[model samples]
Target: MAIGTLDAAAAYGRSLKTLAPAIGESTAATEQHAGGGNSFGSMIETMVSDAAGSLRTAEAESAKQVAGKGDMIDVVTAIGAAETALDTVVAVRDRVVSAYSEIMRMQI
Candidate 1:
């Protein structure tokens, strides 16, 4: 069966909802800590951990498929979700690096 655009969009929305709590918590912590550097570091650490978890989940689903015990649809969905999570993490890392570079080039 072919998936519709709405179905894909809903899946994306669900994934965003899953990440929303972490984002909110990180924001709150950053606000509470003000100039403390650990808040941003912890947020990035959490994101990387979440991405690693997604990749591990996808690997497990693929292994199940290889063992003939899992549905192809589930494998596909898990892989897609993992890919999206990894991409988000990489994008964030790139942005952070770019910002750091810009800061380093600024006049002190």
Candidate 2:
């Protein structure tokens, strides 16, 4: 009988080795934020807030431009930035949910 060169245990061990740094960083972050409840929640909230603020600024600038007191470039930039931020947040949320679903499907 011929033996395959691939070793499942070795492959698993290599994967663990590759993930060691990430696991350590996560552990450190958890310890650092032990008092805070869900750092990711706060991060998402902050991102949404920033996007909302950008949209508000763009709205104000548009009103000012209508009144002949604002720059067209600034208004366009603010709106574009806000749109990008909102899109990014939605993409991140989708990816996170997808990853969670995949993890949940994995058998322990």
- In terms of lDDT, which candidate is strongest? 1
Candidate 1 matches the true fold with a TM-score of 0.64
The TM-scores, one per candidate, come to 0.64, 0.59
Instruction: Evaluate candidate 2 by giving its C-alpha RMSD to the native, one decimal.
Output: 16.4
- Lowest summed lDDT over 10 consecutive residues: which window, candidate 1? 4-13
- The residue-by-residue lDDT of candidate 1 on 71-106, one tens digit each, is 999999999999998788778767877999999999
Residue-level lDDT tens digits of model 2 in 38-108: 66544555566676678788889899999999999988998898788768767776788799999999999
Best by TM-score: 1
lDDT of 2 at 36: 34
- In candidate 1, stretches whose alpha carbon ends up further than 4 angstroms from where it belongs are 1-38
Considering only N, C-alpha and C atoms within 3 Å, which residue pairs clash in candidate 2? none
